[model samples]
Structure formats: structure tokens, C-alpha cells
Target: MINDIALGPQNREVKQYLSRSTRDSVLGDLGKVLAPQIKGRGTLQSTFDKHCIKDSSSHRKYWTEESFFNHVRGSYSTNVISGATIALLWKSFYFYAYHPFPLDLHRDAQIDFDAFIRATLLIVSQCDELLGTRELDWYWRQDTAFFRKASFVRMFRSIAAPDHKSRSQQQVDMTSSLSDAMDVLVMIGPQFMHAMPSEPQLESVARKLFVEGPPVAGGQVVRREDLSALIRLLLRLRLKERIWGTRCHFGNLVEAESGEEYLTEVLVDTLTGDNSGQIVTFQQLTGAIDLIPNLLLRFQQLWAVLFQPSDAIDKTKPQVNEMELNSIGGIVSLFVPPIDDDSAGILRFNQRDTRLTLEATTQVSPDSLDTSMSRLSRGISDDSSAYVVIFTDDASTSNTVIGAFFPIPSKTTHMIFQIQPRFRILRWEKTELSRLNLIKPDAKASLSEFAASEGSLSSNNAPYWIGNPLEQGAGLWVDPNKGTATLINTVGGCYTEMPSVGGTSNTGENWDVTIQQARMHIFTVRGSGDRKG
Candidate 1:
């Protein structure tokens, strides 16, 4: 049944090459032909006639954003064009026909689309924009998974219901056109949680899509599938913003890497399991742990757990089930501090020493521990508790702690902490320091006397400041008169400190101070052994 042309290898290669090149040339010509038709002027047939003629392919102009929008509009309005044909045209031009532009052009498209929506809103006198022709078409063509015809109908109803009694014919016409377009777009398209939306416009759209109930259309009640689709879209958009929105300020740690890669590594760390029995070092875990506090700041609720050497120390061996851990102690116990702090008034786990002591004395069956941990795990998965964990070796330093939004091996050598979908860790920039209350009026006190006070020690009795005595710019200072402690910068004369309350003085000669540094971290207990009375 083979054709004579396919009998020879050389003939087959020649035919394949010709087919690819001819396809490319045809698409390029199509782009030039359709570019002018999208401007809402010529019909698709006229544009095809003007440039798609056999000899008219000589002039190959690049497709611009304006032209792309124009084509999208014109193709949708063309009565002669089928949805499948329009989709094919878009795929051809978008992938191979159009001149290559910067990836930022996609962003520019979004901006232009947004502006178009705003203009449409003005015409309709509605605060919310309609999910019209352009939006539905773009969504269907760009990401068909998230496109739902029912959702589009519901959104249209919400935006089309005008508050004004006197509706203009132009507004009526626009709505009618968009409605027809959406009907076709959704018919051709396939169907597909949350940090709050940061952008005002996104927030408004999200509220409309998720919070507001879907409006009835054609005397039919809104379907659950439509509501579900809207929710999915809202969550996806918010998550997209979180991951790609900003750089995470990891103090000096994020040097030489793009924020996007840094985020990717953190996420990888969280999901990775270390089967090797080697201890996970501080340096290895620092980058991933550095993101937890920022994540907490972004998403208020975080579930966390701590694992010690004795609790499944050999991570190489399959670990206990999460449900097992939950049965013994609920996951909430991890965040709820056994002993409350009055001054700082923040819920925190016991000190490293106390935790170590409890682990040594406590005796529990592995089965019991597993059951407890598993229940705790369920709470986290069910959104009843936060979902993050911490791990520490028996001989680890007491000064610093690490936390993550995922479970890690008990005795893993290297851990990869991935940023969870619900949270985003942004780079804490120096400019943002002004927003925090880190400075106060100076009190009359000698720096030497303040350094000698008991307040110089941290709550855990660790040395509050660590630096070289011989270095002038690298030491700790406490202003006794001002009731504040400062860490002298190693590279600069500036010091960073928490401002003291009620230390203000009206003296014209008051010392002016500025904050130079800050750090944020999240911590939690691995086991409830320490909580036993």
C-alpha cells in the first residue's frame, strides 16, 4: 500500500522538508493577510482576498499587538468564519507566523485587554467589566482547561445587569455582541485556593467570581459546574501572582540567582525526601527555612512539625505514617506553645534544651507516635490546621531554628523546601523597613552601661549579641537609658534594634537613630513529649 514516492529514503526526506517549509510559508502569508482584517474594518473574506492571493504574498509585515487584537475582534465578528477555523488561524500565527517578540508581549496583551475591558465598562456604566468576546476567546484559546461556557454566561449576566434605568443603545449593542461571541467561544472551548488577591483589580474580579452568586440565564438556574469553574480560575490567577509577582528578600543569601529560581529551589526542597542517614546541616537547610517566616507573613495559617534524631532517625528507612503522628497529638499542638510568653505574647515552642531533655525521658511506642502524627497530618490536609514542619538534630546549635510548609525526612542529609501553593515569599527589601516601627526617640544612657544589663541576653539565655571586640563596627551595644539593644553591623557603622516603647524625650539634642537590619523565621515543636506534665 506504500506510495512510490515513499519507496526511497532520499525522496522521503525531500518530501518532509518541503512539507514543513511550505506550511511555514503559508502561515506567514496568512499572518500578513489577517493582520489588517482585525482592525474592525474589513471582513475576513476581504482580507483573505486582499493579501492571500497567489501573487499578493510578496509583502510580509510583522504582526503587532494592535494587529493581533484587531484580528481577534474581526475574526470573532466574521459571520463567514467558523470557530474551528478562527482557532486554527490563531494557533498558526501565534506559534509560527507572527514575528518573534519579547515574552513581555504577553504581559502587554494582558494590559491592552484590561484597558479594553475598562473602556467597555465606561460604556455600560458598570463597575465590573463583562466577560466578553476578547476575554472568552483568549481564555479558550490560551488555556482551554480553565475555560467554561457556563461560567462565562454567569459572568456576563452579572456585568450586564445595569443599575441605570436609561441604558444606551450602544451599551445594549455591545452586550448583545459579547453575549453572542461568548456563546460561540465557550462552545468551542474545553473546560478546566487561595491567597487573597493583592492587586485591586484582581481582588474585585475575584470577589465577583467567587463571592457573588452566579446570575440566572435564560430562565435556567446557575449550575454548580460554573461556580466551580469560577473558583478554580480565581485560585489559579492568585497563585500565578504569588509565584511570579516579586523577588524574595533573603537578606544576603539570595545573591547571584534569579528570584524565580530561588523560589523553585525552595519548593523542591520542601517536597524532596532525604533517605540518607547523614545529618542535614544548617547551611544546607538555611535557604529553605529562610522562606518560612515570609510565607507565614503572606499566609497567616501554616501547619508545621518538628522531627528529632530519635523520631525515625534513620530517614533512609521508610518513615512513620502522618496519620500515626496525628493520633498521639493533634497538629494544633505543634503551634500552640506549652508555656505562654507574656512580654512578646507570641506562641512559640519550648527552647532546644528543654525539648532535648523531654525527648530523652519520654517513652512511647512507635505505633502510637505514628498514629498521632497521622491524625495531625489529616488536620493539615483538611485545612483544619497549618501544613508545615521543622527538623533538628540532637547536637544542633540552640541559637537558630528552621521551619517549612511541608514534611521532611527525620534523618535526611539534604532537604529541598518548596514554596507551597498558598504562600509566596517576597524579598524583604530595605525600603520596606520604613513601614515597620523599628526606630524610637533616644533615651539618655551610656552604651557601655546598657551592654552590662541582663536584658542583653535573649529569652533563651543565649548571648544576645556576637561580634569581635577588636573590631569597632562589629560588636553589640545596649542603650541602658533607652532600654534598647543593638547589633553593630560588621560592614557598616549602623546598628539594628527594636524600638523601646515610652522612651521618648523632648530634648532638642536627642540622638537620632536608624534601623539597619532585620530577620524573620518560623519555628514549631516536632513532638508533644515536652508538653507532658
Candidate 2:
């Protein structure tokens, strides 16, 4: 009873017209062209609007003088601001590297320009290790250099070379230049953390700030070998400011190359409990002791380019502890090893409990002398590394304190956060065998052949189990004649998922037996049939 309405081939004219309409509609909507002419003209135009400037004056003949003047100023302002923003982005990355996770969660203004420079240098050092290139080459690749020199397109081009050079070399050159730029920045970053007195107030402050004693005697200066000295000095300054809850002001210095000056600021505060802006309280400072070295080392490298001394000339004795690690920031003196070695054996500064307790008492407990003294004795009795920490107080002035903890184990590797349970790793011997073929498993080896395995003991020369019954994580059917293992889980007409004679789908599943024993039994039965007497 059904009548068929058969469709015929479409008319060439109608078909062509429909296709042309669809093509045009799509092209118009997406701002593209039909196939074979699919140039991204629309995308290019959008990019031009955001990044390029094409004004009325460039096209028109009747441009006014006022309009021309405004354009020149506008461009200059844009370039300066953009360059600074690029520097800020580098600073953010520096902070992120140390605190891969929120070590100071819900903390604000944790990073400053000094920290930023140190972070960049750390990245360069890591890159150097991975690629065997100069430490500076890791920063300042063409892409990164452009970002640092944003709004100055030509500056980037000047750094990039077309021939006889690799990207690494170009990066090294740029980093060296950038380091010089950062030294000027470090001089001024601490000012933002606190306010300085006016010229009238400086007279009173100057006495307290100036050297009060015959300072630590000078030592032979080994310039290149003493990078740690300079780095430690900066760290001390940073820590001192944090501990005292004070602000530092270093006046404006012009950038060596640009000769342009900009204001810089650095701030540090600690917070406790739920409060956002409050100083971090004493109780909250407990775990921070472990972080001191990591923090100092990380920041030093990040901003290494910025702080490197500009002088090439070597001065033999530039005053040892001239830039004392402890005095610069609100940092308290801790043991730096190899201070002097006159004894039968080296008597280095060790971070013992007593030292930390004594240091803590001097800084924190002005009234609780008895308790502080007890703490010092008790602290020294225990054996652990001691660290000086800066702590903030809500009702009182900032205090520096010391903490003691056993050294972190060597085998421990840090994850970003506590996402895994702590476990002691068992160590084993390793060897550098010549032939990689030694890595291949012998056809005769079984699970028990491995030293640590607990399965049924396999003999030294026992042949490996072959055929379906022994195929792990899969069901197997035995081959009565030519015995050899074949995979059972593959999907095809040849493979089956049906229950075996043991009433289980595979060695992985068992009606009653344990999975491990089940696998072992299967292998044993299949492998030993011919060898059994």
C-alpha cells in the first residue's frame, strides 16, 4: 500500500547556488574566506587594533600641532609603564617558584622586586643544569627578553641574532644586561615596606644607625668565590626588615643604560589566625625554621642578575662581614661554618638548641628572664639544627626568635604540598652495567627470580610458564602441543572471556583464592608439567 517518491540527483544550478550561499554565510559569520582563500584577514585586523597605532595624522594632511604633541607624550608614557609591568610579571614568577603552593596562604604583598630578581636568577641556574649552558642563558630568550623589554620592539630585535648563534647565547647576553638593570632596583625596593624620617628626623636616627663599635675585622676578599657573602647580606637585610616591622628607604638611582629613574618599594608583614593584614603571631612561626635556607637560596638566584656587583676591579680586603648577613635585615646572627679553625679539629658554628634559646631570649623575653634562661638550657640539651626566625606581635614590637628541629632526611623529596603520606624509602644498590641488553628479562625468569619477591620460589634455570593458563590479568586456554604464551584480553574472534576450568574469568579474578597465589599457581602448573618426574 506504500507509494515510493524516489529522489533524483540535484540540479547543477540549484546545487551550486545552495553551496555558494552556505559558503558566503559561514565566511561572513566567522570573518573568514572560502576554502583555497582562507587567509585570517579578520584575526590580523583585530591584532593590529590592540598592538599597533594608526592615527588620523598619519593618514590626513590637516593634523594640528597640539594633537601631535599629545601623541608623542602618550607614546613615551606607555613605553615606560609597559616596561615596568613586564618587570613586575617577572617578580610574580619569582615568588611562585619558592612557594609552589601557598606556604603563606591568604598572605598579601608577600613579594617585592628584590624577591623577583632572585627568582629569575634561580630559574637561570636550574636551566643551566639541565642544558649545560651558562647560568645566565636560561633567562632572556627572545620571547622572554621581549616581555622584559615590552613596548620597545626594537630593543628585542637588537638582542636576537640571525646567524652563527643559538638562542642560549642571546639569552646570556640579555641576562647580563638585565642584571645590571636590577642592581639599581634592589637599592630602592625596601623603601615601600616602611616610611623613612624627613631630613630633620634623620639627625636623631643617624646615631643609632651608624657603626657603634669597632666593627668585625677585615678578611682577605676572594671576590668571585664570595657570591654567597653578598647573597647572605641581602637576605639578612630582607629578614631584618621583616623582624623589626620597619621600613627601609634607598633613594632613587638611575638605571645604567636607560638613565631613567623610577620609584621602588618593599614591604614585609606576618599574619596569624583569620586576620588578613595582621602580623603573623609567634605560634604560627613554628614550622618556618626549615624554610630559611630554601628561601634565601631561592630568592638570591631569582634576582641574581639585578644584584651582581658592577665593579670588575678586585679589592683584596673589602671587610669581611662588611655586608654582615645578620645586621642588614632584622636577621639575628646564626652559625656560619668555618668561622675559625685553630683547635685540634674544626670548631664550626653548629645550630644547637642552646644557641637558639639564648638568641630567642635576648630578642623576645625582656621580662621573662627566668623562663628564657630555662628555655636556653633545655634547648641546647636537645640535638637539632637551630634557625633564627622573625616573628610579629600584635600588642608588642616585632621580635626575632630561634627554633630547633632535626635535619630533614636526605631521601625526602618535596611535593608542592602535603598531598602524600610520609614514608621512609628503602634504598638498594645500583650498577652501571655496560650492555643495555643486560636489562632485558631472560625467557626463563619468573616473578620469584627477583630478589625481593615472595612468590613460590623459582629455580635458577626454571623455564618460564607458557600458554593461556599462565597469561596474567587475562583468561587463557591451553595449547596441548606447541606451548607458547599469547595474550587473552585482546578483542577478536580468537579470544574468549568465558570462565575457565577453575571457574574464574582470569588470574586476576578468583572464586576463592587470593589473586597473587592464583597467578603463581597457574604459572607453576603450566611451566612444570614436562619437567616434573
Candidate 3:
């Protein structure tokens, strides 16, 4: 993540992270099209994709520019950018998926010079992985979390020597950097109000920030090159206080569960390239992490725990609940308090169609089918809230669940990717926005007539389920009221190719008839705190 050519944190005339020459060179071919700051979305119209990348739209609705600015008032710039989080900064920065964001974020807008520089750096830096600008990735399809944390470091530098732009490195004072650190923290917080620490504690965190780089002037000041690194480390330490709304030390979360340990061990070994084909000792895991020059900028984006303290704190073990750790392919879903014995997870798929995945929850039991699936059906059938469909397979090696999530609910009779409820052709993972949203077919077509079928392709209402009904392009479907379901993928290209999902070829595999898939489960994914389906 370090820039070899423009390694001057003291040279404040250029971009903090990306050297000006590098920023300009990267944007040369693109010209002004990918400019960083733009007027606004309405201006962009249809060419919005050129501006913002929208791989996944988890937010059902959007807050107006006015409303959004209000939410991040202190931290976000409001005047020059003027409700321009996406326009000015986001393109070059990492859009945090710490929460759901607006779906209509991409807009046709204009761009400015600094904005352009940031955008170009963002695209060029990770050009090997993500192609262009994009929204927050909920599923993390491409391992990009903390992907650009380094960029933040570049923007921030020597708060001790705050005046990086006007003065030369030789003239700058680095030991005095602590002056602006508090202001930056306050800007990023409603911080740990309940866990407010004493002034000495904050100073300690700030002073220790300059961990790397050579000490300047008889060790009294830190080097300019290390200033950006300090900003990045500071963010990792503080930003979560804003998002998670609780002060967390590693000890609190780790004591609770296996968590991402299996996932952690797997990725760390990949980072360390130790692939010993044996268990990873704790020393090896930590050592591998330490060897990486920049923990935040690893190409794999594989580093899991970024901000562990040098010393342990909070030795008390908080009361923790059992949670199900489900992982498959590049996806990992944790059901806190654990999913019920009956319900499986949810899986939504496809784009731009009325079709959405039918969902299942970790709440409720499959054995009580009479009330479960029926109520889920009635819920979507009646309530007009957004919903998501979660599809899971028990047979897969890694137990990965596939889904497309859209929390917004619509009225049109959209198509559905079959996943069943707590029980229906396994509860066709879906929400009944309006009376099944099914187009009645002329006369009763055979099960082979899926496209023109009399009702939805799959439903958790029981009887016949397709898709999760477990089949390939079939017209007929049947659920035996048992714990199993069979699907035949004859039309082809039905399943996504995931080796962890037992996918053999680069292309999708077929059900080929003998499919005895496991029973369906259900759970609700909402902040309402109710886990019931």
C-alpha cells in the first residue's frame, strides 16, 4: 500500500497517501470522466454506473442528501461537498458496510479535481480485484473489507506536526502531533460515552500511534512517512466506536465463540503461505500477521482481527450466547443466540427482477409446519415491509449459504428464486408482497410449464416447491411433507459454481434427479430484535 515514489508525508502539496504524480498519471487515461467530486446524483441520470458501483443494494430506501448529511454532521463535510459523501469522498474511500446504506446511491453527477484524484487512486490501487466504483459489499464477494484503510492513512498525517502543507519535513515538528488527534477523534465520535477514559489514557493511545518509521531529532519526533500510518491505526481503533456503538476489546468478543477462528486460521495461513497442511499454532498465526508490512493493505484482504491492543484489557468474561457460525465459499453468516433447531438461513439471488429468494430463519421449528410457513406467507402476504430470502444447503462441505438481499418490499408479482420457509417446496424463500405475486396461467399447465405455471415457481405454503424445491428447469414439483426434497436441473445453469458447495466444474452443476435435500428453516433479519420468522 506504500507509494514508492511519493513517500513524502511532509510534502503536503500532493495527496496525503497517493503522490500527486501517481494520482495524475492514474487519471490521465480516464480523463475527467472519473472525477472524484460531483454535483449530485440527479445530474448523472442513467450514466450513474460510471460514477458509483452498485454490486449489492442492501438498503431498500435512501435518505435524502439533506437527511444523510444530518446523520454524519460532525464527521462529514457539508459545505463545499454539500451532501456529497458519495460524490467527493466515497469513490476514493472504503464505503463501510458496518450498516445498511441507500440503494439508489449511484447517480449522474459532475466531478472535481481532488475528487478525481481520489477516485483514480481507488480504481487503480485495487484494479486487480474490483474493476470500478461500487457500493458497500454486504457479502464481501471480493475480499475488500479494510481494503482501503491505507488510503485513510495517506490522508491523515503528523497531527503532532499538523502543518504538513506549509512547511518542509526539515522544518516540521512531529512530537507535537497530539494537538489534532483529539479533534479528529471528537469528529469521529459520539464515542465511548459510557466508557470514557481519562486524558492520560487517550494521550497514551495517541503517543503510541507512531509505531513505525525512524524517530527524528534524537528520538524526540516521529518521521513524516509514519504519520499516515498513525492515522490509519487510529481509525481502526476509533471508527468502530461510532459504528458498533460499544467499546470492544478483542477479549470480549473472542471469549464468546469459535467465531471466525476456522475462517481466521484458513486466511492467516494463506497470508503467511504456511499451508502446513496441519493445524496453525497461535504463534504462527500472530507471527504471520506481524510479518505483513501493512496489515490493512494485504492483497487477500485476509487479515481478520485488525485492532488488537498491545496489552490485554477487560479480563472479565461477559455472558455470551451460543451462535451458529455458517460459512461457505467467500461467505460467512453468524446467527447470534444461534438459529433454532428448525430454521435454516436465508438466500436471495438474481438482479433487477421481481424475483427474490424466499427466506428461512434461525427462529421457530420446521416440525411445526402448520404455523411456521403459513404465518411467514401471511406476513409477507399482508405486511408491506421489505424482505430477504436466505437459501442454505446442509450437504455442502463448508455449509455456505447463497442469497441476494433486498430489504424493501414491492407490490408487483415478481419472480422468485426458490428457498423454502420454516417448511412450504421447501418454503419457497420469499415474501408475499401482494397475493402470491403469481400470474395465473391459462388452464392448469403441467409442472413442466414453470415459466407459465399457474402459480409461483416455489412457495413455502407446502405441497410443491421448485428451486429450493430442488430441481433444474423442471415444470413439475412435489414436496413429500418429509425432511427431504428432490430437484432435477435439466435446463442447466441453475446452480452457482462453488467448490465449497460441492461444485465440480467452473460452471454450475445439475440436480440430475436424485436430490434428497435437507429440510428448510427460517429466521428474521431485522433490527427490531425479534428473531421469529
Per-prediction count of colliding residue pairs?
Answer: 46, 26, 61
TM-score between candidate 3 and the true structure: 0.30
lDDT (Cα, tens digit) per residue for candidate 2, span 7-90: 112233323332333212321321111111112224323322333333466541221222223322333343322343323323
RMSD of 3: 21.4
lDDT of each: 0.24, 0.22, 0.26
RMSD of each: 25.8, 32.1, 21.4
Winning candidate number (TM-score): 3
lDDT of model 2 at residue 390?
19
The window of 10 residues in a row where model 2 has the poorest summed lDDT is: 520-529
| Candidate 3 Cα lDDT to native | 0.26
Alpha carbon RMSD to native, model 1: 25.8
* Candidate 3 lDDT, 271-310, residue by residue in tens: 2233343222221222222122222222112110121221
Which parts of model 1 have CA positions greater than 4 angstroms off?
1-140, 143-161, 165-533
Candidates 1 and 2 compared by TM-score, better number: 2
Off by over 4 Å in 3: 1-376, 379-462, 466-480, 486-505, 512-517, 527-533
TM-score of each: 0.17, 0.17, 0.30
